[model samples]
Target: ASAFYPAALGQTTLEQWHDLFASNAQAPFFLSQHLAPLLKANQGCIINIIDALAEQANPDFIPYSMAKTALRTLTTALAKALAPEVRVNGISPGAMLWPDGEHQLTEQQKQKILQQIPLQRVGTEWDIARTLYFLVEEAPYITGQDIAVDGGRSLNSVQLHAP
Candidate 1:
């Protein structure tokens, strides 16, 4: 389960941090651990859906960002640990969908984000799906890598900091 709790560092509580980690990082870790034997037996793969901002410092969404970054690290570790049997990789998607509820954006904010993407548009779910298909079915030798299906949004650092 991916979490997107947004809060500043000073405003975030320890419980929120733990909850974010539990949802974003810990759950995947333990699930993979429990499924490792089966995965190895069947030669299955693990593809983690991560955020494109996982490597960046998101001050407004501190705990969520930290948790995702931890998941990114976990992806690498799992890839190494599960190698030669099961492949593990991550997909870091950017601006694929609009944030709902309290995190919803205005039209201007949305436009600003679109401008940052080299494709000048948001990504579709199919974008991620095709990438996943490629990784699982075609990319046999690829592992421990993160593919950014962000329409080149990850190529620019200014998108996440839109005002």
Candidate 2:
């Protein structure tokens, strides 16, 4: 499932937070559970689209990060539960799209984020798409995995002091 309900902590209401978890985490779990019979019958797989922030602490986006983190966990757990018949996996994308509307970043802000990526650039949708394709069509033995489609952003070193 490729859908997200994002919300910041302070700016978000409790209901929004609930919805974020519901859409990002709970929906996938329930949908997969309900569709398991069909998928197992057809020997199909499930791919959950998560975010790179799922593995890291993002205080600015606490709800979103938490929801995706739950999704990551669900991916692993579901894989183990529905194995040997229907595989379940996830893809965590990073910087695949610029924030729109009020969340848009300045040019300098965008450049700063790009500088953190080891590849020194943002990733393309094709990068994520190809990974999804690989997990769905090519990798038969792989399951219960969340592959990061980041441009090495997740590997950025922790710097106590800047050079």
Candidate 3:
């Protein structure tokens, strides 16, 4: 369970920051900790879904970016903490789904985002699912690494923030 809200530093409330941390960082850590024994016993893997933007600090989404950075850290930390049995990895995705409701982008903004991707399109949920499938089934020697499935969006640093 993840929550994202577009808010700059001054615009963000403490509660919202905490909520982002809880959703993005704390939940994954505790859940992975609790599931580690079982995963180790079964020789299973842990795949965390991260955001491609986690690598860069977006002023428009300060807390969201921070929390996701923490998740990225936690993913690697857990990989070392649970090594030799349970392989831990992460998938950093970009622009898979358009924001709805209050965060919904205008048509122009959506087009702006599409232009940033080298593939020039948004990704389908199936893209993520297929990556997940690969990490679970095909990837055996891979661990403690994050795979970017962003259609090359991360290759560019331009960001679109709600106005």
- Candidate achieving the largest lDDT: 3
Candidate 3: stretches off by over 4 Å: 157-163
* lDDT measured at residue 134 in model 2 versus the true structure, 0 to 100: 99
lDDT, candidate 3, equals: 0.90
Ranking by lDDT: 3, 1, 2
Model 2 earns a TM-score of 0.89
What is the lDDT of every predicted structure here?
A: 0.88, 0.86, 0.90
Model 1 residue pairs with clashes: none
For candidate 1, the TM-score is 0.91
Error of 2 at 123 (Å): 1.5
Cα displacement (angstroms), candidate 1, residue 162, comes to 28
Go through the candidates in order and give the C-alpha RMSD of each one to the true structure: 4.4, 3.6, 5.3
Q: What shift in Å separates residue 140 of candidate 2 from its native position after superposition?
A: 0.3
List, residue by residue over 1-163, the lDDT tens digit for candidate 2: 4345445556888887887788899899899999999999998999999899887787777888888999999999989898889999999998877878887889999999989898988888899889999999999999999998888888774557778
